[model samples]
Target: MTNDPAIAFRVTALEDNQPNGREPILGGILRKKAVWVDESLCIGCTYCSCVATNTFTMEPDNGRARAFRQDGDSTEVIQEAIDTCPVNCIDWVKFEDLDDLRSQLNAKTIRPLGLPPLR
Candidate 1:
């Protein structure tokens, strides 16, 4: 394994609409902490992927959850993944500091499809 801390993978949130018809809201971040995937805790449900497919994936070998990309160092993507975790296995540190993360996740500068840009 790489001894370099920067070489390690990181997960972040990317806020999106809830599938259950809930109000569209920006999710929070998991802070500098990594989302620990507990094999025993996970039921193999792809709820995480459903929210942030870019950051999460099902490990084919173990049929468990794993990080899909390590490029998610931003708070926006990290929080979205954590919010979507069905089992609540994902947790956050510096939860009080998430205002910045929330702003980044919910920033209206760049509008997604079907949404209008914020003036």
Candidate 2:
């Protein structure tokens, strides 16, 4: 809670001093790997969406990519999307901390697009 509306995610932890919004290249539980897109730097490249169609989709308004469903594709495929992002705006985050990150981001809550057969 600061008054700044741009900050979306927040976490209050006493013992573990881990940075609240640090984005890891490959971290988090395998079953709960979470993905997020940084709208500021995202060039609206379709690389991620094309690589992981099920996991990512382009926002109609800005054409920026967002993760509609973290589990839409396998972690391996999602990684491909992240790697393919030329601007490197996509991030892999721990699922348990996802809510904290989302809450602090300026973006709205994203609903999972649903689990489909992995592409």
Candidate 3:
């Protein structure tokens, strides 16, 4: 693995191996982070794609939004997409905290579609 001394991170290019598209996140010696998209809850609204195109894309088979890579865009931009998801299906997590976050996602808590806005 090649190291970028400036960033102090080991570079592993996913673009060459992954056929689906650009990888969103990159792991390195410094930072450990990840972005997770709940496909079952995704509405395919394209909002996330618009806000953080580099980080997310629609799955070819299901059309739900998916995060192919975590480092394609800035965390702030990706967070905006997560916050704006009408269904609240997107999230960011520490690389080690992914499983814990998954357990907290309960379908019963998901907001129903086309419901009247809160007063």
| Candidates ranked by TM-score | 2, 3, 1
Q: Which digits, one per residue and each the tens of the lDDT, describe model 2 over residues 24-103?
A: 22444456557988765677878998988887888876567878876577677788889999999999878787777666
Please give each candidate's TM-score.
0.43, 0.59, 0.56
User: Poorest 10 consecutive residues of model 2 by lDDT?
Assistant: 18-27
Estimate every model's Cα lDDT from 0 to 1. Answer: 0.53, 0.72, 0.72
| Worst 10-residue lDDT window, candidate 3 | 19-28
List the candidate 2 regions with Cα displacement exceeding 4 Å.
1-30, 107-119
> What's model 1's lDDT at 90?
55
Q: What is the C-alpha RMSD of each candidate to the true structure, in Å?
A: 19.6, 16.8, 9.9
Backbone clash pairs in model 1 (N, Cα, C under 3 Å; residues 3+ apart or in different chains), count? 9
Off by over 4 Å in 3: 1-32, 97-119
Which pairs of residues collide in candidate 3?
A: 23-69, 24-69, 24-70, 24-71, 25-69, 25-70, 25-71
Clashing pairs in 2: 7-104, 8-103, 8-104, 8-105, 9-103, 9-104, 9-105
lDDT of 1: 0.53
The worst-scoring run of ten residues by lDDT in candidate 1 lies at 17-26
